[model samples]
Target chain A: MSASEIPVPQDPADALAAVVALRRLADQLEDAAVEQAMRAGWSWPQVAEALGVTRQAVHRKHAKRLIAAGVKLRRRSP
Target chain B: MSPIDAYLHTVIMEAATEARRQGSATIEAQHLLLAVAAQEGTAPQRVLASAGLDYQAVLAALDREFDHSLSAVGVSRAAFNLPRPSMPSKRPPDIGATGKLALERAFASAPRKKDLRPAHVLLGILQAEVGTVPRALALAGVDRADLLNRVRDAIAGDGVE
Candidate 1:
């Protein structure tokens, strides 16, 4: 979508609230997307690169939750 | 522990659970408000219910607020067809900034620590003029000022008992 086409809330409160809601949506999306990628046999490095974050950062964030979810994760990439 | 201390602990614990259920990384003011509304037979709960804000109502209002806020940016949550993510196995979410602010306001509302009651916590949450709780209350067609007055009255009546 073009910058001009993007909707911006007129009210400052509404705009701020949209930021909060978008952050929450992003977090939820990341969790779901990471899990889906891992379950599909994607390596940690691959997922990290895809997310434009460090492997350690991604692992620290999601490894435990993914493990508990019983999605067998691949070993660390060489 | 003092009665108020114990009550605050239970409410915080319930709020943590609410945070976890909502997949939030921290327990926010909204979660604390939900905890207050869910607590059975409390003066605060009664006060909230009087304004048609039971626990379920609060949850519904918050959900509506989330959707409404997203729509403001031209995004629809229904477009995301992914299944809900698994619950995080980490420790219960700690109290976030908004939650701490509410508690601070609650503590400050009383004349002294000894005067503090459960209703004071609700007062603190209601005192916030912005953020998720206030926005949700507004969108739900509830008069926040009226609710705040009711909570204050409840606290005052409890003091006389």
Candidate 2:
């Protein structure tokens, strides 16, 4: 295959497989970015806003994992 | 339920959670391997930890793998920002073929009517010979054969003592 040519999937299975793989890669990038943001002292709301998500949604997804991984999180003042 | 059963469930559940967190639509063997390494105090966890393959270590290994993969495509994380794509629906992603194979092998390898342990899952992963776990472990300077031996040792009731 040529470098400039993107190969089309030969079958439905191939197409679906590609979609799954691409989504996984996206998730990995998101996780990496979120971790970097937290490491740089960004709050949950800030990170969520950057990703166009609500604070609750982002926090609900990542907070526990971040804590378990020993990423220091800033307190959100009420 | 036996402790082994509980631990295997934890590993599988954590692997699913990890897949979702990473935006992966399929659960791969690599994710299961990571879940085993991250579950603290488990036999597989201890074995991996002794080889410096803890959660952070595995993450670092994965980062390197991602970097290498991007470089292969002539892109770099430093070159551009990665877009954060959201899933269109709330439905969870399904397990991939390699992951399904590994899980089946894990069950087969498990002693009949006994709890399935992390070591069994680890062995299953190795046996599948697919997915990114082996590559990531290699990137982390882990000798696959040696690690396999250690995991077997743990399963044989050596490391728990």
Q: How much TM-score does chain B earn in each model? A: 0.97, 0.84
Clash count, one per candidate: 0, 2
- The DockQ of predicted model 1 stands at 0.86
- lDDT (0 to 1) per candidate: 0.93, 0.71
- What TM-scores do the predictions have? 0.97, 0.64
Candidate 2 chain A least-lDDT 10 residues: A12-21
lDDT of 2 by residue, B33-68 (tens): 789888887777888887888898988887776665
Off by over 4 Å in 2: A1-78, B82-90, B158-161
Worst 10 residues of 1 chain A by lDDT: A69-78
C-alpha lDDT of residue B156 in model 2: 82
DockQ of every predicted complex: 0.86, 0.08
Model 1: per-residue Cα lDDT over A15-42, one tens digit each: 9999999999999999999999898899
Interface RMSD for model 1 amounts to 0.8
User: Residue B142 error for model 2, in Å?
Assistant: 0.6
Q: What's the TM for chain B in candidate 2? A: 0.84
- Model 2 TM-score? 0.64
